[model samples]
Target: MSIVKEFKHVNYLWEDSVAAKLAGDEVALLIYRSNLLGADLRLTNYGGGNTSCKTIEKDPITGGKTEVMWIKGSGGDIGTLKRSGLAGLYVDRLRSLENVYKGIEQEDEMVELFNHCIFDLKSKAPSIDTPLHGFLPFKHIDHLHPDAAISIAAAKDGRKITQELFKGTIGWVDWQKPGFDLGLQLKQCLAENPGIRGIMLGSHGLFTWGDTAYDCYINSLEIIEASAEYLDQNYGKKGPVFGGQHIESLDANGRKRQAAAIAPVLRGFCSSERHMIGHFTDDARVLEFINSKDLDRLAPMGTSCPDHFLRTKISPLVLELEANANLADIDDLKEKLTPAFEAYRHMYKAYYDNCKHENSPAIRDSNPVVVLYPGVGMFTFSKDKQTARVAAEFYTNAINVMKGAEAVSEYTSLPRQEAFDIEYWLLEEAKLSRQPKPKPLSGRIALITGSAGGIGKATAKRFIDEGGVVVINDNDSNRLESARTEFNTQFGKDAFAAVLLDVTDSEKIVNAYNEAALAFGGVDIIVNCAGLSISKPIEDHTEKDWDILYDVLVKGQFLVTQKGLEVMRKQALGGDVINIVSKNALVSGPNNAGYGSAKAAQLHLSRLNAAELGGDGIRVNVVNPDAVISDSKIWESGWAEGRAKAYGVTVAELPAYYAKRTLLNKIILPDDIANACFVLVGGLLNKSTGNVLNVDGGVAMAFVR
Candidate 1:
């Protein structure tokens, strides 16, 4: 039967008018189709699937039309693919590899041969699935890892179900590692099952094809949607999901408290091999799976889809806790966490010993990429925030697969040997080796106060450039949002998050750190730059002036840094705290009593924190920036006039006066201060703490003795 286009859940998105506009452009239609398919995680996930199209194009040298294939390239996600992200290969040349094709053992060699088939000099490197796409006879193809299809593919009677779902229209192929051999098997399956619309690769994914891009898209949707409908109709027929909930979940607020408490602790343990950035999700589905009885039995079986485990790892570490355990009791959790992580690492080492081939990349980080907690949620960690987030998403997909597969039939994961082969595949290792060396702060998370402008914003940018994820906390909502947008654009949306917060508000400070916990796992660096000045003589300073100055500069810095320390202590990961004190803290001048005294308090606070936090591996240092007149909101707020008056110069001459008085004849700017913050936390001062770095143009009076 032809496609039964009943999209009760996954909708039909192909617009006839849009497809008509791109009728003659095969590659454009393919990309459009790929984007549509990828837009919904229910259909396919980030970087999970590959789409391909073949077209007749003019040969650059021959001046004749030639058949060329355009396929989503390695490291490219179908949803965000661009022209440059597609690899263009001469179809005839790609097919010529078959003449010299060897067996499955030589499959890794075929990927190198694909480079020789490139028809466009600028084409991106082809993905490992290139041969699978090239070998197919169809002009357009989609290989998607939709949960619905994979549910049936992972079902115990998967082959039998595939035959039942499409009858003879969709053929079935047995499992084999992805490569030249599997590509040939796909071609053979289609040839044998003549006129089949698609084929189901056992324990793999769905494959659909058509003569045109539009037809190919519709074909993929029909198969996936039908599989979804089948699962929906059949779910609950067998029994309750995951053998029903084994434990009831804590209330919403309680769950967050527990998750926040557990996040850094888990992150610390997981970072044993290397520092890991973290992402957490209490997504209802995730909670359901973790709270279920089958979690213990099933999670160890691992994910059925290769794409899922490639990010989530072969399996997840399921946190075992007593039913109705005290969610707020972190000490109890810590006791359990230590032995649990030790057991997990031991399990992983043994897994490697059992399955590793001689050429396998010497055992990778044995730490789990994914962790499942009952009554709380899921936490995923990786080398960067994006990877960590994507891993969480993919594992949630795995959860859905497990749900559907169990509802229909017993869920099955790839055999351990097979999973090991793919996970430690030579190709995957090559990809890892080719990855760029990590930036200094690759997985570091920073929480910067007053980050909406001036030194804070510049420091946030510097940390982001060095691969740190930042939380921009400032009381100015407008400027905070503007800075957030600017950094999001310059660096990527995942680079930073913004919180409009009053630092002195202890409650808000707590919430901001919790937000940081959820946004990037834990804090690795803290920058206390929030300050305001009440620059008046002691006699002119009213009680209110002293209170406001101390509230902002002294108390606010204390609260923000204290909260940051809480997270850093939980992470148990050595962190850096850079306090943006000022030169006035050391060098007293007229009309600077209140502001200067507050800066002095801020400076001393750093020392106090440094002394106490040393054993915890958190280094506290001070950066004193003087004459940072440009772009400073504090400077704009009457402090410039007060400082200029005290220095015996006009506001405009303040810069020149400060520059001339300096031993180095330089005026400090926000970026210069940012550089000092970066230097202290950027691994250079790992061995130093309680020290103050002066960013002011060398002033003898301000020099720390």
Candidate 2:
């Protein structure tokens, strides 16, 4: 069934309206409403909605004050807008003026009036809808034409049908010119229906209002949703099937070979197809669309949401791929694509020039928003794959809706200039602007196993603080959950991902790496922090304990390192891997024979991997830290008492006794261990590989390196 339904009572309001009403002595109500409006629009995409509100008061000096309206300034989404987002205007003065102010009907008069009165007390011009909001009677008003709204409206004689369905229950406004004229029409309609809860502007959008902000938001969502349910009962289509035939054309090596082999054939075919290729299609609609003689009615195949413009650009590629045609030659394909690409560039330049005003910045030249090759699938551009995926997702939704709209009747879009205004507006440009880079690792991906506590979490935080994207893996699901939530709060959902899996399991390790790759692209760095410690005299050490330590400390690190090497090798990129061994590898520790021997073996493995993988530009290193005082279970057991007795110290003071031996006189912290790991992997040590770095506060002086 179609995925269109009015938002339930649960998620109707995008923000807490109670916060808007609670604007105290410091914060103004207008500013709160502006912020709330911005947030809502930002959360929804693809021409989903707009918002506005009114405020009144008397001037303290004249014992007389005038009322004013402030609406979410146009062309800006709530996600990035500030209080300045609200365009201010004289409410009573605007209300007194007849809706038809201009003698000649100007298409954008409402938008123009908004601009005319709300002068930028600061230097910028106000939006064009300020006055329209000023003329409305309600304190708060919101309008949205979301995907859900369209889904319900995409049926036989949609507007007339919905009108008949709701009869007297819902007020209806015919699709008039939007902006000032539409506002005026709405004002008159509201006047006639004084107690109307909500109104559906036929073929336009839904309008909801309330004495309080929350009620208005809720009422708007409820009525629209109710209408959608009514429509669903009468007409529904099966949900779109997403799974497609898995085309396993090539593996990594196979793709490279295919690309080389097919490039020449494709190139030759392009020479002929460029001339006669426009006339073939697998689908009838595709053929009709390509052959349409009316250039003026061309559908804009981009996103419905404005933010999508940043990712997918303003259009899509129209490819002409036929089942029997020759797509085998790369050069021929290039020959055809070259002209279409040039045409796209010329069109883009014209679009940019037409949209240009005195205040806009130049558009980016190389990043074409959409590429339409006749036969191939559409491809959206993003700085990274994650963003492009979001664009692709929105494209799917938008294409379906546009198709449904066409099926009912003609499918039109927002006016070109209006879309351009929003598309290239300086304020909107600022909305998509990124923050300054955090560190060398800002966009790089890293995987750290056993990261929920101790060295793992410490290392994860250090990476994050430097602007790195991190994926934490641990066997403890509960700990991973807690760590994931806490870290996400600090770094955004994109910056951190937590996986629960045992690194010793080869299949699990491979799957975890795959997940991280999907989440943040290929992994760039790996920190194997999942080792173990079992302290016991050689005579007391059990085979089971010995096996466990070796399995986790040595085997886990080895398997993870192997995966890291494979990924880095394929990418043809340089990367780092730091193994958390121990100083015990250099100097033997009594009653911890199992822990010491396992660490020693892991250290040797690191050196071997480093030597072998260095040819592929992968650096492997080890951090040897001594006697950490943190949550190490071995340090807390009675074995600690045995070690303390041997050293002539009480169990309580054993940690202090160990700390005093360090030359730095300060206890070695996990942060210090993490810092050491960073130094070895970071660029400063770019030339160094297969090195064992010590981080024991000078407690261990070894030549084993």
Candidate 3:
């Protein structure tokens, strides 16, 4: 594939002549170039590369010109980079520190020195590679870990191959752990070879620089394209291939079902008490790699690059799957997979024990982050869906790089000791330390039905606030999209996903549950909050009204709960199921026979499920809320007027009328129900099941015994 250069897009940034006339023209250009590099996954994986431009800016306090390096900041992707993501450091101060940190040995101390050179006190911490950028005297610098370059850079004779391909156009540096000393080495290399246009660091990545952002970007593209051309010339025809001989019997749906069965067992094995989500892909290249005869020898050869060790473990776990395995029986699948996982853990522990040093931090979990199953292809696990996707993408790139290298010569990896050092590097650990403390449900996934508005929306938001990923399902497509946009704006784009589903339709419910499982590893919490209130006397209630109420409140809850049970059972991870019932379920209300009776049936169904699922450690509970008239969709459907008439009060006075009747004289809000749902599903009521939590401001008649 050719590199994409949209020069017109770059020119448009300066078109607002007024904004460009003021300041930050260079910074804006750097941001645009960085985003362009980040946009191509082949050029850089998520948050994997750094870029910088050297410019002069006047100090706010001193009113004197100062040379500064505007470099990409930590913990943000270059694709969506903004002004805030670029850390500006005083170049003179950073360059002068070359001698000050000359003999410092600790990694943390070098990082401290790097932070001290920040020109803006409020700016984010500069990238760990800032020194390498600062040491170079170029007007602009770009460092990328492109897969094509990595295939060439990570080989046994990487330096020789790079020199042969670029022919003095690029310089080479042997692999050294990145820090102050490596920065010094980079400077010396440039001083020794002044005519080279770029530097290719052994087993690491490539560095290119020029006088302008456009020049540097083009230089990077050219170098990478040259490497790609070399790979094509050598092994273009004999690339890795996958055949369908083994799975010729199964259709696409059958293959997906097989993966669904196997994914949960793998996810449960990888996860500890803290949940982890798994993503699976059987892409042609991945399948070819897994099904190869030499997989056993090639899989454990270490990561494609050093940075990948941070996301994927040092190596992937290679598990063998039978050619025509029967995955319909979960017990049989678990039986076959359990021993393999155990062995993998033992092997990982041994690897860590042999390489650990005195200063090394505690060994990370022994579970493999990436798992390769012969028939299932690759599965990547992480605390969240986005991170899992990132891991999967990097591993896929690694496979391509290895294939290219293997086509030329044997694939080589860093020594185990060096891999361990980079894996435990302080800079990598610091990124994790910078995050806030995780909430109780941080990595769990929740599925909330009827989430377009009212109690369901509130509950979905609450789950997201607690760091849990959510799936919001509603039959109304437009309302669901609107709610999804709002949630995405308030929380994050990946915080929740929206599915258009009518819960009463069994087929739709099944598809929605499957969608949730595919998006996340599996569902850990199910909140049954989809319902419509019908305020009519028993004599006035029609057969159609009865069917609708029963279908939504009773049958819908039954179908959703059953689907949730199937996922929980397959995952073998304990989960929570919460039914949003009503106060009328306990105490009969006038003109509310249809709604109240259906709710009562739902409450009973939850109790029965609690008793049955307790053996599997799944907790089933119910929340009974009273008179949540304000901001409720049930009220919008004429329930407000009906309830107001029943209470002999106007619609505006209904809330106060119900509030005065309660012992606490408080109006029940949607948030109150949401809080109760959180308590049940967030593990606060872990030991209690089949219990009803009251959220009605202490109603005298509706209080649970």
Q: How many pairs collide in each candidate, listed in order?
A: 0, 36, 0
Q: What C-alpha lDDT, on a 0 to 100 scale, does residue 645 get in candidate 1?
A: 79
Model 3, span 341-446: residue lDDT tens: 8888888778778988787777778888898877566889898878888888888888877776776566787788888878877667777788888787887989
lDDT of candidate 1 over 1-705, digit per residue (tens): 233365776867777778788878889989899988889899889999899999889999899999999999998999988888999999889889999888777878889999999998999989989989998878999999999999988989888888887887888888788888888899899889889998888878988999988788888887888899999999778888899988888888877877777788889899987888889888999988999888889899998889998999888998876534664555666787889899988998898999988888898898999998888888999999899999999999999999988988889999999999999999999988888999988889999899899898889999999888999978988888788778878988778878888987999999888888887788888899888876776788889888999998889888888888777767778888888998889987899888888899989988999999999888889998888877888976778888777777888898899899999999788899988888897776689999999988898999899
Off by over 4 Å in 3: 1-24, 58-65, 102-108, 237-252, 322-324, 636-638, 650-653
Candidate 1 vs 3: which has more TM-score: 1
Tens digit per residue, CA lDDT, model 2, 1-705: 112344642244344455545654111443444344434421244323556666655544456766656566555544345566556666654554454467424444334444445422542344444444555688777766544444334333556655565665556666553455666777777787777766666444566677655555556666655654553453323222111121222234432332222222222222121100011112322322333332123445343334334445666545343322454453465566567656666777787888777877776553343333222233443333334455554444444334444443444444446556666755556645643533655545679888887888888988877656688877878878888888878776756777887978988887776566445445678998886666667887789988888889898888888876655543345678999888888786567687777888988998898888888778888888876768553454555766776577887886678778888766777898889877876558889988888887676454463
TM-score of 2: 0.65
After superposing candidate 2 on the true structure, give the runs of residues whose Cα lies further than 4 Å from its correct spot. Answer: 1-50, 58-138, 150-215, 226-300, 315-400, 403-407, 410-424, 432-440, 488-495, 569-574, 615-617, 633-648, 678-692, 700-705
TM-score of 1: 0.96
Question: What is model 3's C-alpha RMSD?
Answer: 3.5
Candidate 3 is scored at a TM of: 0.92
Better of 1 and 2 by TM-score: 1
Cα miss at 67, model 1 (Å)?
1.1
**TM-score of each candidate structure, all chains considered together:** 0.96, 0.65, 0.92
lDDT for every model?
Answer: 0.87, 0.58, 0.81
